[model samples]
Target: MESRFAEPSVLILVSLASGPKHGYALIKDIEEVAGATLGPGTLYGALSRLEQRGLIEALPAEERRRPYRITAAGAEAVQAYLEHVRQVAAVGLRRLGAAHA
Candidate 1:
């Protein structure tokens, strides 16, 4: 199978790039940053995959919550992914602008 990060996984990494966060915190951050609300199952599922891929790491539990931080590889991944997104958006915007002109 092709090993590609899903949109939710990308968003999770994006959120963690700023700092570490627990499950609920990650969910809220994703909603705030991406404007998409992930259910508990979806959010935790992405977190699990991200951890398995070494994109993020879980810190020791603080109280009842365990937070995960992005690894260096995760930051690189985010940078590359955003660049791709930027290129696509720029081209699409240019096309739309010309169409309206």
Candidate 2:
């Protein structure tokens, strides 16, 4: 199946791939990587969707913070999305020339 990757989903998947993390940590990581803060409602909404899709699963809780890990399917989806983005960037870069001069 084609990846259901949107901006938030892709970002969340990438964040989880590094290792399992709690919701707050994931939000911080994504914001740090993106150099901007993502809204709490938007982040939790995407997390719910990702969990519902079976791309991520909740880990045993510690101190009321629920951690999550990327499922195998999530890895595949994120990889495919990244590859597609790379290809698009490559095409755009290749088209850059002295046209602005």
Which model scores highest in TM-score?
1
Cα lDDT tens digits, model 1, 1-101, are 54233489888988998899998998898878777788889888988998898889999999999999999998998899999988998999999999999
**Could you tell me which residue pairs clash in candidate 1?**
none
Clashes of 2: 0
Over the full model, what C-alpha lDDT does candidate 1 score relative to the true structure? 0.88
Cα error, residue 60 of model 1, in Å, equals 0.4
lDDT of each: 0.88, 0.86
In candidate 1, where is summed lDDT lowest over 10 consecutive residues?
1-10
TM values, all candidates? 0.90, 0.87
Score residue 30 of candidate 1 by CA lDDT.
Answer: 82
Model 2, which residues run further than 4 Å from truth? Answer: 1-6
Which regions in candidate 1 have their CA more than 4 angstroms from the true location? 1-6
- Tens-place lDDT per residue, model 2, 1-101, is 54433588888999999999998898899878765456889888988999999999989999999999999999998999899999997887777744544
